[model samples]
Structures are given as structure tokens and as C-alpha cells.
Target: MSRPFADGEGKVGTWVNEFKENQDVTYACLRPVQTTVLGKTAKVYLTPFSLNDYKLEQLKHSKSLSEKNSNYMMVCQKSEPKKTCEEILIPKMKVIPSKAESTLQKLSLGVHDESNKPGHKSPSAAAILSADMESSDEDITPGVDDFSGLSPYEKKRLKNISENAKFFASLQLSEVSARLREMIKKRQPPKSKRKKPKKRENEIGCRRSMRLLKVSPSGVSLPAPPTAPMLIEDENPLLPPGPLEMIPENADDNHELFKGFLQTWAEMNKTSSKNMEEELSSLKSYKANLNGMVISEDNVHKVTKGSISSVALHPSETRILVAAGSKLGQIGLWDLTQQHKEDGTYVFYVHSQPISCLYFSPANPAHLLSLSYDGTLRCGDFSRAVFDEVYRNESRSLSSFDFLAESAATLLVGHWDGALSLVDRRTPGTSYEKLISSSMTKIRTVHIHPVQRQYFITAGLRDTHVYDARYLNPRRSQPLVSVTEHTKSIASAYFSPVTGNRVVSTCADCKLRIFDSSCVSSQMPLLTSIRHNTITGRWLTRFQAVWDPKQEDCVIVGSMAHPRRVEVFHETGKGVHSLLGEGLGSVCSINAMHPTRYVLAGGNSSGRLHIFMKPGSY
Candidate 1:
């Protein structure tokens, strides 16, 4: 959705005028605006890609207060597809001068630029980082005397003016101080000695005489030598021998010494509250990533059990069907919003192996299909996955499976053999034919054109391909365009639901790319490419790229990498948001169920099918 224009196109003017322009954008926020460390001075504005998205945000689920703590945006995806030597060479070889890549190269370079406080890394950002590093150094930690860089006056001004800033950095020192004290409190005090009290000689002598009389009365008789008090030597004054007196309770009632401590304590309290809120949000994000099962409208039918491979709803009605996996390999069906099944609830097991991919017909929601790695494609008849004897084939392993939305006779499959095949699955009770077999070297996912029945796109393990599926007859399928900007294997790709001509892809190289077919011929052309990242807990795998049905340009993608990320990228590929996923697990597969809404089903070797769905509308 990037409408890349020649730079310097918009004239700077008043805010209202800027807002009214035909092609206007909110000022490109490089970063979020923040007050200085003590909130006294304004440093710069920052646009941060807050890592607090993808959590449960349904009406019933209250808005998380932690989300407010996230103060960043404009996340950059990693390296996107680049014009490869192959793509670049083709146009030049044909004597058709390709558009000079200077512009695109510049744009791409800018997207990857670390020059300022924008994208992932920026100069100002780096400066802030250096400041942080210096502050954290054990040898240089700021204290009462560490004034290596600041003039005494500047330091005093910083303390006086920005000391009361409500934001975080303003009270960092105080917060740290409180934390230190907390740690110190965890330690027990060492034992100490006090001075022994002295007595007068006469008092000592009288005490001795009493002792002798008492001893003699007890009949223990040893005559005391002179019965006089012995002289005592002066003990070292520095060596403590007795209890030290407590300082007076009201000694120096001035509270200045504790002002900083109290400030720190307050800051620590604020930080703790913020942390608790974040923990709660993280918990919700965790649930959102794997919440594939939902109660039927009537709440009578429950979709549960082994990992759910797919969830589908009737195209026009309230009927829903769920395909799940079990140790015994079973797929279940539930009548959501309906209670008229001849059987109270229908359950069926039609495969001996775990279900790999499943889908319901766009034409008739009740009708569905299932494909397994076991080399089988099973069609469904409302209640169960009945064998479609007509379209079965076992030539190679099937990695992905789906039916074209048009009541067409085609089924698309990406195989382990690194080939993509569009099988004519119209007939179901007999042996079938190989409609079309095309290879992409390393294939990961294959799906039909949302609006163009004639074309289909294949996200290869390393590249992206657009094929003319109408040619599945061998006479029709031919390459429309091939994109190889990604240097690594592409894990997922999606054509914009609204803009069929535009495509987006994510790859192992940690990049997200956006392109339009119309501009594909422009040589160095693409709407845009983004390269920032989130979802940093796992290795990225089986991914699904999707467009927001409501806001056409909004997009979301699931990551298979550690701390699997469900990132949202804007249509222009300029904006980004990283959300939480089930766990650090590889994503097996992903697909969109509707234009505005979608369902995600993926699992790792852990046997848990992680399902993410938009909460309410679906």
C-alpha cells in the first residue's frame, strides 16, 4: 500500500493544510517525544513500535493498563526482498532499459538507515544508548562526586529544574537508590561490642568485702590477698566493648538527607506497579497466541481436544466446523449457532496420521477438506472427512493444502519435493489426474489469488513466485512475476486482501517486503520494504501474512522464532507492531479465514496447535 512518491512533493505548511492534502501523512514520527532524564528538558520525539500488541482486547477483556506504558512505535522489519541480480538482469538483457535503481536503492537504503533516531537504530538513539552505557559503567556510575562530563552548575540546574518530572528517566537516580537500600536490607548486621562500665575503687573494695563474707558464710575459705581492688588497664578506645548509645530521636530534624531516598522509594513504587501490569498483559498475550478454541454461539457445542488444525464457519450462516488432531488422529465437527444435527454432536476420525492442513469451502461453509503429511487429501461432507477417492494421490509429501475460493475444481498443495501442484479436485469417488505440477526449489506455502482466479502466488523457501494458475492445464500456468529480494528462505507470504495486486512476504533473513504487481515492471519498484523486528524468543517458521479487513493497509504476521512474534506491519510497510504468540515454537502454517477477520492454526513438535483469532466478530 506504499504510494512512493518523488521526494519533496509536499510543501511544508500549517497543520490543518497538511492534514487536508490529498497525499498527507501524520508527521513521520522517527521516535517518541520524551522529557530529559529528570523530565526537565525535552530531548527528542520517538516513534516506538510498542511490543504490547496481540493480547486479548475484547470488550469483555478489559484494556490492559500496561499497554499505556509502551512508548515506542515505527518498528522496522528486517531485510525485505531486493531486486536480485536475476530480476535486474532480465530487463537489461531484453534491451529494455530498467528504471535506474538509484531511487529505489536510495529508498531501500533509507529504510535500512541507522543514521538517526528512526527505524531500529538511529544516531540520536545511539547517543542515548552511549549515555546509558556510561551511566551503567561501574567505574563511572553517577554519584555525589562523579561529575566527569557535567559542569557543577549544569548538574545543579538539572537537579533543580527537572528533578520533579513525572516520567521515568527523571527519577532514575532515586529509583536506583531505593533499590540499593532494598538489597542492603536483605543483609543481616554484624555483631558489635561495647565499652564495659568502670567502678570507683571504694565501691569495688566494698563489693569485694561483701563477696568474701558471702563466700565464707557458704564455707568456701580462701583468704583474699589484701582484699583491695586491683588496678585496671585502659582498654583501646577504638576497640568497641559495650553498647553504643542511640542517637537522639530528634537529632538534626532536617529531612534533606531523606528527600532523595523518598523520591527513589516513590519511583520504585511506580515501577513496581507498572511491572505488575506488564506481567498481566504478558499473560494475556500468551493466551491470545494459542486461543484457537471458542464456544459455539449457543454455548452448547464446545470445540476442544487435541490441537486444532483449522476452524471454519458457514459462508452465510452460523454453522461452524472444527478440524483437530488426537493421538488417534481425529477431526471433530460442531454445529455452532445451530442444534439440528441428526446426532447430538458429530465426531469423526478419517486419518491415521495427524492432520496437516484443513479448510472449509468458501461457497458452502459446511463443506470442508483435510490434507495430511501422510500423502492424503480428504474432502468433507458436513459431519466428517469422507475420502474423496477421486482426487487422492501419494506421489510426494504434502506440506500445505487449500481449496480455491471459486467453486472451481482446483486444490493447491506445496510439497516436500519443493514443488507446487494445483490438483483438480472436483471429482471425489475415483482415481484422479495430476492437473499441474510446478517446482519452486524449496516451497513453503501456496495460495490462490484472492480476487484473480487466474493467478496464484507461492512463497518459496527462499523466494516468492506468482503463477498463472489458469495454466494448471500446463497450457495455462506460467510465471507472471518472480520476487527474490529475500536472501533467505521465505517462511510466509500474503496478497493484500483488498489490493489483490499488492503482495507481502516475510523470510528467515528477518525482513518483511511489500510490492505491487503494477510496479513490478518498474524494475526497482515496490510500494516499500521494512526491516525492524520483534517476537524475539524463537526461530521464525511457518508464518502467515494478513491484511486488516477493516483497515486495508494494516497487516499482521506470525513468527516461528523464539518468543514467536505476531507482528503488525502497515500497508506502506513503514509501520510495525510486534505481539505475543503461544511460545518459542515453530509455526507450522497460517491462513486468513475472512477479509476482515482470520484464524491462525499452527503447532510445534510440542503437539500443541497454537491458534490465534480476532476475538469478537469471528
Candidate 2:
């Protein structure tokens, strides 16, 4: 038997042997058409049919013989026709000639290879030459030899180039283009000579503090002694030697001058006190008096080296003495009465950190007490011309302090860690008299009640708390009155200076709250909540609302509004007066009012002091 094979016309056939019952052997032809074999579609061609009697007998018995046979083509199997044609014959590979070879052949056939010729030009250059030689006619045609060796794309590109050249020649732009090229070449900026950057010295590493560098595992080392001082004549011959000394050469004379100032300060404070009943009755007139106060050129002065953190007024009604403390721990004393003498200003470095509080002793007006974040509380004893360490807690920084007793010898101090310390000046040591722990995270301000000496209020975190001094315990002590309405941290809180009947608080939520505290044993009811801008950004000190010590019915607070001014608001949530002046440009974050005088002093972040007082009152 022959193996199956496909013809050139896409036809396939096979030959097989037939089995006959008559014992006769013959060849049988199997014809094929488009049909499915197993599962795949296949194209088939049929050969001439030759069947034996046995096959004819089998066909006669087949059931499909009754159906019509189309041109004797039998369908063996059926399947769905494919959408695409499937080639049964292998495709012949067609060889394509190389473009370079064809082009070379074409050039060899009488066309010259112009690319290598010295006199030959590019297609674009040739086009420009032809455009210069030919007339401007749309129908102008070039010789067939010009483009015979080029592709259709190259020929079209040459035609486009030639047309562009003709258009430029018609516009007479060739000379202009040449002139523009010449001008561009002539106007080209000269290359700047860049100086080679000097190789920088190795960047200096950050210098650590001398104190830190001197520390060792065994113990801290003290700083080395200073070198000998240079003579004034050697340093600057024009400068006077006496003023150049850190310690004045005429120390005795300076001491005498300071002693005389102290004596004058004591004598001014000796003025008799006014009747309390009469002053309290004149509270309305006092508010009116504040309204009429004016800020003059002499009233504003730069008193410290940095932002003022605390301010105080001397308890002298006969003279205007203002003391201010700065964030850099400098204390400035300004006397309005002697403004003509060296601007009446004296500065002293009293602490190593920001001064948190400054107060003049009511009992000894000459002694000015100052508290600092350096964990030191000192009194500027004018009589002794020294800063006496009243109390010191090296473990924690002091936030604020207030006199606890009328004698001004007992002090109540608040620590940054929300602890309280009671200090007595008469005690021999610098340690606190008593230390009380608190649950608050921080204590921003502390104020003692004027009438009720045993009661005091503290403002910090998100609440203001009032505590009874006698009942305070280290283990646990409950607040007598907790003002909890503040949604944010409270900056400062103070009791009415004379009667302690009202409490004024400033909060980070931009509100000024006044509480009625006449009945101190119970919760203080919120009397008024006035909207105010208390947001002083990181560089400025926080705004604190304080009370007019002379007027119990009004409160004084710094304002952040434009046309910068300090505001005095009544306890009933009404604006009493807005103190504005020409020299008061910045927000006065810290302010103080004289106890018995009609004087108001505001301290700004730049360490300047602005005072407003009735004409000639200061």
C-alpha cells in the first residue's frame, strides 16, 4: 500500500487493499474532502474511485445510500467552518534584493555616483542652484536624469526644498538671512571668565558648650582662669580707662550713688496708704482715670536685652518706679521721675534663664524679687547692692512665684513640673520651706489671694485650679475651685488685687474669662467669656490678662488687633478703653498696673516698656 500524500493543488489521497468474500483481491481508493479528523479541521482531495464487489456489497448495506450524494462526494464527518483559511501547503521563501546593492546597480547603469565626487553637491544644494538658475514658473520641470537614481521619497523632498528656495529668492530673504547670521555671530556674548572657587576650609564642626566639654565620667571640671586683661591704652587709647573696667574703678562712688537711690526709693514708698474703703468706692472713677491715660515719648523705653517675660511696679505712690524682667534674665529698673538723668534706666543680670516673675515687696519696697526658669529665686536688695538668693531648687525650673504672706517674707513658688514650693526668706537656707507635688503637667502661673491669704489659684494645662494653702498635701490635695471650661491650655489666671472677689483668666483658646469668686469655698461661676486673640506665635511671649490693682472692677489684657493697643475690659464683658499710642507698635504680652497709682506699663517681646499714665501722674 502507498503512503498518503498531498498534491500541488491542495488535494490529498490514499490507496488501501479491499477484503472480498469471493476471494477476489482488488485496490480501493479513499477520497477526501473538507472534513474533521478526530477533532481538527482538514482539507482533503479525492483520487479516482475503484472498489471491489465486497465494498460494493458493503455500500449497498449502508444507511447513507438512501440520501442524495452530491457529485458522488461522501461527507465522512462534519464540523463548524473556521473563520480563517488554514494553508495545507508549505509557503515558498521569496528572496528580496538589498536596497544598497540595487541602488549601486542602478548607479552603475550610466548614473554617476555624485556622493563621492568633489564637485558634486547634496540634493538640497543642487535644488538651491537649480532654483537660482531657473525662472519662477510653476510648471518648470527638471530633466529625468536628475532624479533617476533617487527614491520617490528623496525626489519629493528635493522638490520641496527647491520650492522653498524659490519662495525665499522671490522674497529677497537670502541677503537678510546672511546679514542676520553675521549679526548673530558678531553679537554673541563673550564667555565670562569664571574664577575657580577657592577650596573652602574644612567646615567647622558645631562647637559644644565649654561646660559640656569639660565634663568627665569621674566629675565635672571647672573652667580655666581668664588671661590677663589688656591695658586700655594698648586696646584703644581714645577710650577712658575708668569706664572700661568691668568693676567700676570708683566702686565707692557707685555704691554711694546706689545707696542714695535706695534711700530715695524708701522715702518715696513711706507715703501713707490711702483708705481702702474710699479707693474701693472710687473704682468707677479709677476706670475713668485709666481711660484718660496717655502714652508719651518718654514713657516708652527699651529696658532689657530680650523679650520681657515679667513686669512689676514699685509700691511707691510718690514716685513712678518700674521694674521689668526679660527672657534673658535681665532686670531693668526705670524711674519716670528721673527720666532726664541717663534716661533713668539701670539693668542687672540676675539669673541665667528667662525671668518668669518679678515683684516688689510691699513690706520692703526697696527689695525687688525675681524668679527665673533657671530654678533660682533672688531678691535684688538695693540696700545691700546684691542679689540675695532667697530660694533655689536645682532639680526643677521655677515657672512663677507670688508672696504668700503680708510680710513678703513667705513666698509661694510654682515649678514647671506642676509642683508647689513654700519658701521663707527668714529661713537660713536656700531650700524651699515646704514642697508639694501636683498632678498637673505644668504650672504656668500662680497667684495668691490678697484678702484670703490661705487661698491661691494656679493656671496651667487646660484648667485653672484654686487651692487652700493650709489643706495642701504632698500625697493628694483637691482643688477648692477648678475652672474647667477652658478648651485649651490656660496662660495666666489672677484674682482681684484688693478683695480677691473675682478671677480673670486668659486661655490659649483665644478667650478672656472672668469668674465670680466671692464665695471661694465653692465653684467659681463663669461671669463673662470675651472673645480675644491670644495667639502669640513662638517668638513672642504669651498674652496674660491681669487686673488693675487699684480698680477691682476691671481687667487689663494685651491685644493682637491692628493699630496695636492694650485693652482694659470691665468684668461685665464690656470694653472700657483701648489704650493706643504712636510709639506702642508691638503687642504687649506682659502688662502691670501700679497698686495705688494711675499708671499702666506694658512690656513687649523686644524688651521695650510702654507706659500709659495721666499727664504728670508718673
Candidate 3:
């Protein structure tokens, strides 16, 4: 059988449009004929923007009338509504102009009844002739100096010689001249230095050497080589020689034996000198000691912070929310929202949690991602808390979880059983297990790539895995991408929304490293390396790092450092942004104030939860 659109005999009816143009509705002779050429009724022509302004105005008016009357085309739609996008666009036109109206066409052939100028290939015979003649008559004669001497003709030749010489000298090419007479004629006034081309690197170096070495650091003339002193090979380098002796190659003349002796002595004094300089600079600058922060901001306002498990803000970042779960399996969600109304009193009791994990669902406003300590992932409705239904999985432990805002059906969970499960939340009762890790090490963090929601990027105890969710729904096995960078367990891995190709990982070594998600290698180097301390068993898992919502170059990291520290890394993503001036102390979490930016709200081992708003000026 032939395809649906194929004409009989397999000859495509390319003139179907022409055939339709002449056809008219003939339902028992009730509908009349319609065609623009006939100039009867309201007829529109289909062309490259055949709608003149006047025709458009008429069509719009007709459309409005049809809408108000609900009689004309509306009846057909009601009978058998055309629901497809193509069907809806049939009566509309978003016309692209023809060649004649395009810029280049308009330029070549001027508008307003002018014959558009022919393009270069069509240059006129007359134009070509004129150009040829002009070049032939004026350019090839020998230098006029060939005719220099006495009569009127001779004087003219002499004047020409002087003018040509002056022109060449203006270009500074007179130095290339070998003839004495031409050189004499070229004696024009010297040109100003305003137009010199910039000097090349080697030329610049040569010039600097000639001008600088002639004077010493003390402003006294020095012999050639401007003093390359014999630099003592300091085992511990001393205060980099006095400011005056700090010149390049500061050592060449000292005897090797003496240089060695000086090096040994210099090493012992380096640390003391460094300490003195640091103390001096610290004394001069206004220092900020953020040793402690009030984590439970206005402790009275806190909803019993120690029991708090989850906190997130609206996509708009206008509010803050917190969820606390008690040992009694009770979960409580409070409006710890930062907007303190001077006049309004609190109404209380939103949602509570004996929560295992709180995942804010970005795609659906009415939903949230919830993990019960019982190994169940529930889709909690915003309106009430019984949850739509229980999604129980007993295969492995649901250790941690995260959600993707772009996909309406995905649920990503991390497991202590060493599996990263991608659950289908839409049909929660009949949960579809999209992916379960094949590895044996439990995953610590599960993050789904927003740009590719079908890909679950999970951090396993030993490696990071990127699973293509399409593998699950389609029953296809697209090999997962596993990156092993962290020496010990890979506790966390996050990809920035600004650029999907980059990701960061933190691990047991108390170090944070960045990787190009596209390439995972033993030689994968970090763009930024940060270490916490030397303490053993101090897993980096206790800390959290979040990308700055307002700037792609900045990342807010919470550290296990004593008195705690929130390191703000700027330009660490791409060298374009530099690190910031201050760090946060005792911060446990960085969450959105609203969906736009975040306030690092965290507490320390001291049982405090401080809310530090990102600096407004940043």
C-alpha cells in the first residue's frame, strides 16, 4: 500500500494547492463560491506576505466579528474541534518576506521604483571601461627625476621630483633611499610621533633594557647586566632581600661556597619575618573575626532547630520554610519565613515531619519530594500532609534524595545500600524503578541534572555516576558515566545550572575538587582545591556547598573547620570571577531565601542555626 499522502499511481500531486484554489464548498448548493480573483466576499490570498495592511485590518475585523457572533467557523470547530497546533495555525500567517524584500536585494536594487543595482558580477561595460582607462593613463610612468633640469618642462619635472620625495619621506621610507639627490629632496619637516605602530614584544624588551639598566635601583648608573646577584639557595628563603636588591637574577657573582652558607642561615629567619609582616598588616587593617554566628537567629523565632531536618524557599525566594521531625515520627513544617511583619501575627501550623529527607519539587507547584525513614518516597501535596500515596522500596536504603524541577515525573534517591534509584513519581502506587546502581557502594548524594532531567547524577561512596533515565522508561541500557576523583568516599557532587558541563565533588579527605563532567580521568585536575583539617575520620559529608543563584562564578561552602567557616569561592568556576573577601563561620546549610538567591542558614556542633543573608552589594 502507498503512504497516506501519496497520490494514485504514486505520482505526487504537487499542484494540489492550485486545484484547491478553484474548488468551492458545495453542500446541497447551500455554500457559495469563494476566490480572490473573483473579487467576491472576503477572500485572502496566500503568498509571501500577501496581506497588505488594508487586508490585515479587514481580516482582523472579520475575525473579531466571528468571535462575537459565534456562528461562522465556530460551528465547524464545535462539531469536530481541531485540537492540534498545526490545525490552530491554519488560518494564521507568520510570513517571511520574499527575496525582493530582503536587505541585500533591497540594497542592490534600490527601492522606490529604481532598477536595483546589479551585483558585482554584473558591473557595467561602461564602468569597466572607465576604470581600465583611468588606471592605464596615470600609474606606470618612471619617477619624474628622470627629466630634471632647465626649461619650463624641466622646472615642472623638478617640482614633481620634490613632491614624490616628500611623499616617500612622510612614510618614513627615506632611510631606504641610496641616491644622495633623492635624499636631499626628501628633506621635509620631521613628522610627529603620534602615529607610530605599537612596538612588538622583542622590540619592547630591547628598548626597556637599553633605557632601564643604565640606572640602578638606587638611581645610580650600573655596569652591563644591571646586577644579577648570587642568589643564596635558601633552604628557607629569608625576607626577599631588601627592596633594592630584589632585582631579577639577583645572584651571579657570589662564590658557590658562600652562597650555600648564606642559604642555610636565610632559611631559619623566613618564618619569623613572615609572621611579623602578617601581624603588621593585620594590625593596620580592620579585621573581622567571624568566630561565632547566631545560627538560631532570635532563638525564640526558631521552631526548635535541633530537630530541624529540611528547609527550602519558594522559587521566588520571598519566603523561608523549615521542617522538623521528632523521634516520635512526627513531622512539623513551620513558616520560619524571614519576612517579619511588624503588624501581622503568626497563624501557625503548616506541615510537620518525622522527615527522612525533604525534596522541594520545582516542576509542580502542588507537590514536594518526601522520603520517610521507612524506605518510602512519598509525593506530598502542598495542600495537606497524608501524602498522595506511599511509594515503598525495600531493595536498598533510601539514604538521601533530590529532585529535578524540569521533569514532572522523576524522583531521584540515594541509598545506603549502594544504589541510586530513579523513581517515577507520577504513578506513585505502581512506582517504576528507572535505575538502580549496579555498584556495591552506597550513594551519598543524588542530584539530577536540570538541563537533562532524565540523567541522574549520583555520588557514590567511591565514585560519582550519571545515569541516563531514558534507560529505565525505554528499557534500554545506555552505560552510566562514573567519575572517581575523591580518594575516599565521594560524599557530594553538584552541577551548576549556568554551564552543564562542569561539576564539583567533595570527599572524605576534607577536600573539594571540581571536574569537567565531560571528561573523567585519573589526571582530572581541580580548578579549586580546599582542605578542612588534619583530623582523622572527619568525613567531608557533614558539610554542604551550594552554587550562588545570582552569580555562576560563586559557590558557598560550609566547612568543618572549628568555629566553622563558610568559604565563598568566586570566579572559581571560570577564572573570570575571583574568590571573595570573607567567609561564613558555623554555617550548616545554604538555601534559597526565595527562588532567586540564597541565605546560608546553618548551625554548628554547638546546636545553633544562623541565617546569614548573602551580601546585597554582591
Best by lDDT: 2
Candidate 3 Cα deviation (angstroms), residue 142? 99
Q: Residue 283 of model 2: what lDDT?
A: 51
* Error at 393, model 2, angstroms: 0.9
The TM-score of candidate 2 is 0.61
Go through the candidates in order and give the C-alpha RMSD of each one to the true structure: 46.9, 24.2, 39.5
TM-score of 3: 0.43
Candidate 3's C-alpha lDDT?
0.41
| lDDT per residue as tens, model 2, 1-618 | 333322222223331111113222221112121111101201111112221211111111111111112111111112122311112111100111233223223322211233333332223322222221221122223431243344322332233333333333344444555678788899999999999987669968787775677765566786667899867653211211111111211134456565556566555545446765464646567657867888978788888888999999887777888899998777888778874634367677677679989988878787788889888888776655667777777779899999999989789999988899988778665544788986677899999998999999999899888999999898767788777899998999999988899999999999999999999998899999999999999999999999887688888989989999999888989998899989788899999988767788999999899999889784
Give candidate 2's root-mean-square deviation (CA, Å).
24.2
Question: Alpha-carbon error at 376 in model 2, in Å?
Answer: 0.4
* True-structure Cα RMSD, model 1: 46.9
TM-score of every prediction relative to native: 0.42, 0.61, 0.43
Model 1: runs farther than 4 Å from truth?
1-348, 352-354, 383-390, 402-405, 435-439, 470-478, 519-524, 532-541, 549-551, 559-565, 574-618
- Candidate 1 lDDT tens digits, 398-466: 667656657746677777666666566554444345545564666666766666755667777676777
**Considering TM-score, where higher is better, how would the candidates rank from best to worst?**
2, 3, 1
Query: Compared with the true structure, what per-residue lDDT tens digits does model 3 show for residues 1-618?
Result: 111111112222232233235434421111111121122111222223211321111111111211221221232334343343233222221221232123212222222112122221222322211111111112223432232232222222122222222322343332333355465768866777788887787663434553556886676786775677787784322121111111112224444533332232223221112221122122112112222222333322333323444444333233344433322233333333324421111111222223445555555543545564446665545443225543555454466677644555656666676655666656635767655554545666667665666565667677776766555433333336666666877656777654545677767677767666544322334566656432323321155455554443445565445555456554343321111223434344333223343444443332233455434311
